[model samples]
Target chain A: MKKLKRSARLVEMTQFLLARPHQLIPLTTFAQRYGAAKSSISEDLAIIKEVFEDEGTGELQTLAGAAGGVKYIPKMGREQALHFIEQLCEKLAEPNRILPGGYLYMSDLLGLPGLMNEAGKLFATAFAGRDIDCVMTVETKGIPLAYATGAELNLPVVLVRRDHQVTEGSAVSINYVSGSHKSLHTMSLSRRALKEKSKVLIVDDFMKAGGTIQGMVDLLAEFNAVVAGVGVLVESGEVETEQRLLRDYVSLATLRAVDAKGKEISVEPGNYFSRK
Target chain B: MKKLKRSARLVEMTQFLLARPHQLIPLTTFAQRYGAAKSSISEDLAIIKEVFEDEGTGELQTLAGAAGGVKYIPKMGREQALHFIEQLCEKLAEPNRILPGGYLYMSDLLGLPGLMNEAGKLFATAFAGRDIDCVMTVETKGIPLAYATGAELNLPVVLVRRDHQVTEGSAVSINYVSGSHKSLHTMSLSRRALKEKSKVLIVDDFMKAGGTIQGMVDLLAEFNAVVAGVGVLVESGEVETEQRLLRDYVSLATLRAVDAKGKEISVEPGNYFSRK
Candidate 1:
């Protein structure tokens, strides 16, 4: 790469850092890439760090040492996250979202990339500084949220399949009760998909009794992996406290009520805010 | 927001543009956000544009007139994309990726956010300037790829479910023959999931006889939608020409052979390069 002006270097540096989150990059690499001095690179980073902080995008952590460089920690400020979730609740509360059998139609909301990206940032903010190795979610709806969170955290995502596929050879399968009906269901994960003793973060789109999440946890036990954390986009408030299979988890929104016949629905910010 | 220094503004402007790809943002928005003059915002965008172009990250397209604004079109250069696809081919060629039925284990690679992000950029580049309304893919493996492509394209993703879930109110289901065994399988899409006559871009993880992709195309016909394009991560070379269901599609890599017993595999750059 040829030498670039300070303005060009600054723009390039910002783009580079934004693309890579949670990974440390040495100043020398930037200096060399821009054909600038280490001092210039550090000065450029300082400017980026301030803007990132002021704008509530995230933090630019600099480590001081021979082997240290800088790391970008993607996050959404508490106030901004709250505002976003409030808007999400408003959207989720739309009467049209109520489907048959008291189910809510959230696939449309989940389809938005911008919305998913924001939700991912919130989850990353909530789970920041945790020793998590990877993000795990069961198909077929939770995959997008899991990938979004994985992107923000700079971690790989592992998907738990609802049915075993020949493509995922030699899988460990587990059965658990799910939904309001307490119907038995089977979920599996490929043996090669996860490493033993991995600190995994479980993510999902929705949780009722948390039986599905419990199934994932139980499946993880077969692989000797530890559950680092659990995050869900929505949780059923209708579930009785005693009926809930999981105790500790994070949710962005809580589905309060759904009146299918009357076309009424209610949604509120999840326990994420109160948990803090 | 308060006024910011030139350096801080530059970093913020870069981050802003990077996040909202393919969406036009008026200069006035930046001006108001930074409490800066339109001239200053223009200058900042110019610098960011130059760096983005020079780095081959993407292009910052500026429109003229009252409604005009700047839009970020994320792209990967042909040479850079080829280099990436070559690396992907090498990774796919690993003998250990071979499964019992000669299926390659690509879940780990697909799970990588960085890789998916890059692949998304490549697909976005390939399909740049197309009249794409939404990105569509089947569950459960292709969701991430579709979301990745959707994020890059700044569009929504519609998932075609393998089985109809009650949560998806009313849906249109289609039956198609898939795999070497030619077994019939069902796929469904929620009626509310897609708008009528939408121009959709289909994406997937792999294609053998193109049966699954064809199934998605056939299902799209139910909604009177137009197939704008199809993109796949890998295609099988073993599928005979006459037996292949689809012809027009883009792929990153091609699986030439997989010897599960001998632990041998062969992979190469797909028709994406040849099509170009």
Candidate 2:
């Protein structure tokens, strides 16, 4: 058989994969398209696969069996995810993030995808083998990251609002104390937003005093849903109250804030990227 | 020259691209490395390039000069970025996102990467080809997206805080109102955090009004820096002030809250992937 030229073979391989997402394509088809040996197609697959994997930006899966073929799954690995969050935390620890009245100026973190992607990936992996129907997060800040995680898992994400809007219809409201020790603040979720018995992964941009998270836990109970896990992008280590409520928690960085001189310390977890 | 078997050629090509970050590799190198004719290596490069590009997760740069080579730059296209954000905005618009008070629930957006990666790419593209010395964002929510944008641009990110911290060493502070009009807020930046004459890109998770964004703009002016761009993952048409402040603005989704039925609408921008 005449061997197909390499350029033609490459184009055929790309076309085959692009046609199907999350589905495997056999080597034989590529070889047949190029009139080259199966071995030639395998070589083409190897090159394509390596570039995606090395970038830690996408996935190329090689299925080895009678149905063996390669599939590209856009995925971020555990290590890559952690490394990304750690870097964000380090930047967060800088003095610039501290706002008056001890608040962190977090508008940027709320919008950033690199940090959000890593944080989402870390939490997603924790619940990977579990049955999670949806991702739950609070508003203003958590929206971007939750949206990211939901897309990665291909699951629908539901938001829990703090106020009752005329549009939300009926909502189950929970009264909680504000972080500033003000009057009881109300956190609510739409009655129809969560499905009964659905497993949920709760995520928040920042955790302090456990009031908002606890409110979410209460809201999940309102629907008879299961709280699968809890994740936070930034957890204030200085605040001692929140640690007691966390179960299966992943924090991108810990905030060590010094009160007197206004100094802050940051640390990243080692598990963000795989060592091997 | 004799061409190597297809399998061996692929493995070699994959390994080579993985080691080089942001640098382009030419087809000729593969021919020389595998002792294959230029035509053969060209075939391999074409195949590999197509797969990565089709995924909308990474970039492939083809150079024609003798000094030029095939460079695989890890990036996401504009359309993919817009699609991901549009999906998130749709989720956010649900009546479910409304809480009891006038606040949004955004935990899901912060935890999702597939979405965040897209948002990050869009922000990176907004500032592409510009002189951006550093990326600045406030802490907590904005940190992750800022890091993602910085990583893509290969630049260092600076975090701004709300208050003065001794650890960050004498920060400059500015007070601004919250977009929600809930309270007065302060934004801070370490006196030494940003260098003078630097070009900065401002990014965050959500922009309700231009309040926080304006504060950051003022802070940059204090540092004698230029605002290269302003990017947000979500822009609330509910609040319409941010559009006039940025020369370049990109968002995955726009929130148009209409009527009291709690009905909201969203759409992704086609330009997110068009530039690539």
Candidate 3:
């Protein structure tokens, strides 16, 4: 923690804020870190703040009073987000991505850190000011997206397993029919994984009929948790148009139509922006 | 992008390097972005690079020549890595984490963005000069860890599935006994997941008797790929002492023994440092 010049300090501070988004860092902390006065730290933050907004990196919110400081809220520009989602739609429309049951193969996209981090930032932006305690998702594919959003929000991620694992200790398990398959599947969460009455934001890689989301909502009820928001990377508009399971959720992309036999499909940006 | 003051340019430059680790960013890009002379960008990078190294944030390698530029390699300082690993060992030793059959509950740990990022940086540091093409891991539990490391290394992640799915098109699957259970498990990588003769880094959440890691190594052989390195977050030392399937690997935490009946466990830092 040696003293750094103004240029070096600004560089380090930018990285510091970027690394711990949505968490407040008091001016005093930065002041102490650099052995500078509060006024100087404030000036440094001002420069960092302007550049962040200009580049659509995120937002820098400053609080007042004794506990006042700065908080970095990760945000993706609307145009950039739309562009990324449109690219995602193109990937989904690929013939090879079609599965046996009309599902899209997108685990590769979900597994990319850069893509997940971008999507996570968008989710964080959408759910900002909800006073979210943590982000939640089912195990497997959704875990990366959930973690990415949690990182952006500086919140923890809670995972609900497809099957109860002994390692998780005693847990709560609920059976619900999957949206696409209609087959009953059980999802469980450890008692310690989530606290009672917590405000949670749920995220997933894809949603078919919203059955999985509904199941999560039902499971949240058992712990007296509030579902502050639900976000999905892709939603099956085809299934929802026929029979919807849940409403009032945000989707970044929508699967408009699918032709499994001909391997023809169409995808478009979801209700994420339209809802706003 | 509008040209900015020296202060603003430094902030944007730092973020750009951080976002795309390991990719050589030409000096011309930054110079043009800011409309600044190459000399000024070099000066700004000097300040940023010094702070990055001083904070143990990462390494900034500046390459010379027509196609060369600067590359950011994510790295965690040794002290910080050790501290993080110690914290992990403590979390692992918690009584409630002990599950049936001596498995430790760690999905929560893997789900933490901050923790995973740190572990990813350490892994990136361990395999710094291996010329890795991608980070690889099996589906489900190991996805998050693999993605984390891939992010730090700025490489794509290749996922091996427990069961082959039609959506993946053609796949190469191999059955191998899990180290701890000795149960035969089939792991498959999509034909498109990796390239022939590519250098791969294999990562996992937990390793017991090194069976899963060995499975991945053998699986890589199917693609005619080379195993550049292997890393795990936690390893079962007791089981490994009894029978180890692989000897060359890096682990962050070592679960020495687990007393399921007594709910007491002995844990320590892994051979990560000793491997050096």
Candidate 4:
């Protein structure tokens, strides 16, 4: 394997840890893999730690004693976790989401945490070993899922605002089309929110046209940062374009919406978490 | 110290882990203090682990190695930590917070996260060993501070909404009159959100008339929960009545409203987070 630069190693580290939460890896392992000193690795961890805390997703822990290593645990409470899964079951039972025409009401599912937190966990689990700095999500509905994912990883969540707020000041803006709306929408990030070359896990509530996802990909590039991973809360199982994005794309819930008389539907877990 | 009940011990354990994170404790010691079996202590730790994971605070980690036991790390990242404080400072600095003469405008500062998070951490650091299950705040503005406090402890945030939302279902409401407002403002909590006998830490952005804090106390009575501690982001240094209600209070910044000339003001850290 080719040696990765410090920034690239940082992205890889974040992605690795996010993938397998609650499993600790010794600092020496990362140092060995990156061909960097343990102290340098520690410094990188500190930067990742700062950004994650700022964003509020998953957290990094320095374990003590021999055999101690870092681990990432998805932050899902007893009530909140049960509430989410129950809601998923309830939402899946809804006929509108299971249209006989094989179309799902994913917009509704995308906004629900019952399904979203799973996606967040799976994504975090997938990148558990890679150095992921922060989880980035675009504005509006994506915020909740983003927050949940960030919380699990003990990382801070940096929101990509669609419009500039006076409080956020001048922002770095990008343009993309809505898959559902097909109309163009702009996504922006506060210049102060994300630093150059930070490793980011890109997540969204749902992926339809994926224009927004593509826009985010471009935005990360503009900042000279790498896109460590891309995951979604919901994905339309039948979409061809979403399939072409990557061979390894993951989704929490796949809806095969069937629209007929009264509508019918089926729901299943996505491959993101299962891959691990 | 009096031997606390198993439930209280659990709450205390959770609260302790929530604060002074990343410090380890032996199972034998914890069991000895609580007068419970080692197995029971293990089970209590499990419950706390589940709770913290669910609430998104940090994590309760147990090590089985020869030198290992359990430790809590305030898992949320440094940015998450500092961002909240900066927010409070900025909000407290607002001009309207300036009172008549030399007094600072503080209404906005009362519920801000930057201040609240700092105050919350200060309290969390001090009461790291007490039994605190929830962080309670009165309606509207107080919610932010409450959420900040809850975040530090990895406790679930339950807001006392001012108006009932269909989303929250039926709620228990209370009325209060503060020095700032005479008309009774109502605070409500969904009956389903809080549990009876919970050890709660009552927190608010500001305490002026003491009416809002009193109303929160009354609401706690309705739930049969215990008040573990009380923390305020900023306290009116001039108020004697509000000062009397504090068991433990943390003030990131204090203000004494000035007269017309704006010449005199007093500010300092509250006793809550001071190193003994």
Candidate 5:
């Protein structure tokens, strides 16, 4: 790359940082790329850092010394996050989104990139400091949200399949009872998808009695991976507290009730808002 | 929102545009947000537009007059795309990635957000001008890639499941012959996942005999949707070309051969390089 003016460098640097979140970039790398001095690169990064924090887009952390450089940490302000969660609640409250089993048809919302990006950022902010080797989710709905969070954290996502596919090669399979109905369900992950003794963050779209999450946790046990943390987009508030399978997890929203006859639904921000 | 200075305004505006790719923003939105005049907003957009195009990040398109706002059309330069594809081919060529039945074990790469984001940008660039309302792919492996492409295109991703789930409500199921073996396969999409007569972009992680892509195209017919375009991350060249179920699709890489016995594989940039 040719040397660029400060203005152009700022723009390019911003793009570069935005593309790579939670990954450190040494100052010399930027200096060489822009054909500028390390001091000049540092100055540009300072400006970017200021703008990023001011806009509540993220944090640009500059580590000092030889092994240190700069890393972009994607974050959302409390006010903005609250607004986004409120918007999500509004969308979730829509009447047509209610399904027969009190399951709330949220695949549409889950599929929207805009919403997923917001959710991903929120999860990233919540788990920003954790040493997560990968984001794990069951196959299907949670994949997008997992990918979104992984994108923010610049980590790989591992999907736990409901049934093992031959294409995955050798795999680890486990059967567990689901929360909602106590039905026997099998979930599996390729042995190669995860490493032994790695730290993992588990995430899911919704939790009902925490059965599915427990299944994931049990599956992780087989991999010898530790659960760094767990995050859920929504946990069923209607489920009796005693029935909840996992208590040490973060949630973005709580589904209090769903009256199919009245076509009504109630949602509130999850523990994410209250947790420090 | 507080008014911003030009420097701050440029940074915020860039973030806004990048976050909402393919969506048009009226100039007045920026003017009001920054408490700046339309002319100043226009100038900021020009600077952003210049850098966006110059860096091959994307195209900043501006519409004139009342409803006019800048839109970010995510794109990857040919050089960058080639480099990315080559890197992907190298990864794919690894002997371990070759699975039984000539299947490429690409879920790991697909799960990596960094790789998926790049592939998303490449597909976004290839289909930037197409009239696409949403992206479609099968469940499991293709979900991340579909979401990645959808994220770049600023569209929703519709996942067609290999089997119908009760949670999805009413779904349209279609059975198609998959791959060279001509085995029977079934795929389904929720009735609400797509709208009638919408233009859809089909994407997948890998293509062998193009059966799955064709199945998605066939499934789209049930919804009265049109296949605007098809993109695969890798297409198997070892499969007899005549055995491919469909043509007229873009592939980022081509798997030339996979000699599982010798522990060697060959992969190259796909037709995406030749297509306009």
Candidate 6:
């Protein structure tokens, strides 16, 4: 790398920090990379930090002393999050989304990269400051959301398979009832997928009766891993409080109703706003 | 947004372009947002563009005329990509990753957000000029990679499920053989999941006999969609070339051999480098 002008250096520095979130970088490294002095690097970072703060994109935290440098903490502002969620609710409420058996069609929404990215940021913002070792989700539908959150938090994502696969080697399997009918189902996690006593954040696309999430929790106990927090894109509000298998989780939207016969659907912002 | 200093504006402009890849943003929009003249905004974009190109991060494409604006096309440099894939092969070569049936366990590597982001960029770069409407992959393992590529290309991702779910509504399913054993498998995609006659890019984590990928292609045919391109993280070099089901695909790494008894494994950079 050659020494660049201040304008080019600023552009490069911003891109560098954005690419590597949550990781600390020493000021000396940037100084040497740009062939500039430490003081000059500090001043450059200061300008970047102010713009980041003003835009509400994230935070650029600088630490003092020899061991410390700077870290980019990705965050979504409350107003931005609310605005995004409100639009998501409206999209989710479209009458055409109502399928048979009171189910809502959300695969299309989940498939949108931009929408998933924003959802991931919201979960990251909701779970920020926690000591989350990794993000966990079940196979299939929840995988994308899990990865989205993982990318935002700069954490590894551990997937729980619905059925055991030989490629995973040794694994722990558990059975739990799911859905309104309480049908028996099995979920498994690879033994090597998670470390013992690790603090894990659970995320999923949807939660109904909280059975699948509870299954995940019960499976985590086998490895002695702690549940740091749980976040879901949508939760079934129709489920009775007592019938729900788990509590103390965050949701971005609540599926209030799906009138299959009437071909109507209703969705609202989740408990996230009320909790705040 | 209020007017910002030149340095602050530069940082903000860089962030803005990075976030909305492939989406055109008019210079007038930025000019209005920053309360600056279009000339000033153009100068800021020029600085950002230079840094992006020099760093090999990507290209800032500027369009001319009334509806014209700037678009960011994310790309990974050839040298950087080669270095990354080489390191990925080394990681995949670890003996512990070799499973019982000569299969390599890649869930850990795929779980890594940083690694997947880079792989996505590589795929995006490989298929940059193609007319890709969406990214397609199978259930479970390939979803994250598909979403990653979709994120880089600013396209939607459609998942093919092994078993049809009621929530997905009406779907088109096809049966195909997979793995070296050539066992039959069923894969289905929701009819509503994709538009008719769409151009799609297919991506996956691994390809042995190319059965799974072939299955995805067969399923795509049912939707009247066109296969724009195909990409994979790793391909099995051990499989006879004649036995492979698909041709003309990009791979980052190649699995040469896996000695289960000796606990030894071999991997190398895939044809991605050779193709260049």
Number of colliding residue pairs in each model = 0, 84, 0, 92, 1, 0
Model 1 chain A poorest 10 in a row by lDDT? A173-182
**Model 1: residue B62 alpha-carbon error in angstroms:** 1.1
How far does residue B73 in candidate 6 sit from its true spot (Å)?
A: 0.6
- Please provide, for model 3 over A196-264, each residue's C-alpha lDDT reduced to its tens digit, 9 standing for 90 to 100: 999999999888888888999999999999999999999887784657787878898898888999989
lDDT of 6 by residue, A1-276 (tens): 899888889999999999988899999889989999999999999999988887788899999998989999888888898999999999999998877777788999999988998899888888889999999999878888889899989999999999999979889999988857779999999999999998999999999899899999999999999899999999999999999888899999999988888777888999888876
True lDDT of residue B255, candidate 5: 88
* Model 3 ranges with Cα > 4 A deviation: A100-102, A240-242, A261-263, B240-242
Candidate 5 per-residue lDDT over residues B1-276, each given as its tens digit:
677666666667777788888888888888888889999888887888888887889898888877878889999987788789889989989899877866667778888988988898999999988899999989878788888899989898888888987778889999998876789999988899999999999999888898888889999999999999999988888788788888799999998988888888999989997998
Question: For model 5, how does the per-residue alpha-carbon lDDT over A1-276 read when each residue is reduced to its tens digit?
Answer: 877777667777888888889989999999999999999888778778888898789999989998999999999989899999898888889989878776688878988988998999999999999988999999778888898899999888989998888888789999989887999989989989999998999989989888888988999999898899999998889988888888898899999899998999999889998886
Looking at model 3, give its docking quality level. medium
Residue B180 lDDT (model 5) = 69
**Comparing 1 and 5 on lDDT, the stronger one:** 1
Interface RMSD of 2: 8.1
Write the number of the candidate with greater lDDT, choosing between 2 and 4.
2
Error of 5 at A95 (Å): 1.2
The residue pairs in collision within model 3 are none
Regions of candidate 5 where Cα sits further than 4 Å from its true position: none
Tell me, what's the RMSD of every candidate? Answer: 1.1, 8.2, 1.8, 13.3, 1.5, 1.1
Cα lDDT, all candidates: 0.91, 0.64, 0.87, 0.60, 0.87, 0.90
| Candidate structures ordered by DockQ, highest first | 1, 6, 5, 3, 2, 4
The sequence of per-residue lDDT tens digits that candidate 4 reaches over residues B63-87 is 9866878987444334444455455
Candidate 2 lDDT over residue span A69-168, tens digit each: 7775555665666556667867776666665456666655544444555566566555555677888887646765675566556566777777764545
Measured with C-alpha atoms, the lDDT of residue A270 in candidate 6 is 96
Local accuracy of candidate 1 as per-residue lDDT tens digits, A1-276: 979888888888899999999999998889778888899999999999999998889999999888989999999988898899999999999998877778889999999988998999999999988999999999888888998999999999998988999988889999988856789999989999999999999999999999899989999999999999999999999999998989899999999988888888888899999887
Q: Which candidate leads the pack in lDDT?
A: 1
Q: What's the true lDDT of residue A64 in model 3?
A: 93
4 or 6, greater by TM-score: 6
- The candidate, 2 or 5, that scores higher on DockQ is 5
lDDT ranking of the models: 1, 6, 5, 3, 2, 4
Clashing pairs in 1: none
**CAPRI quality band, candidate 1:** high
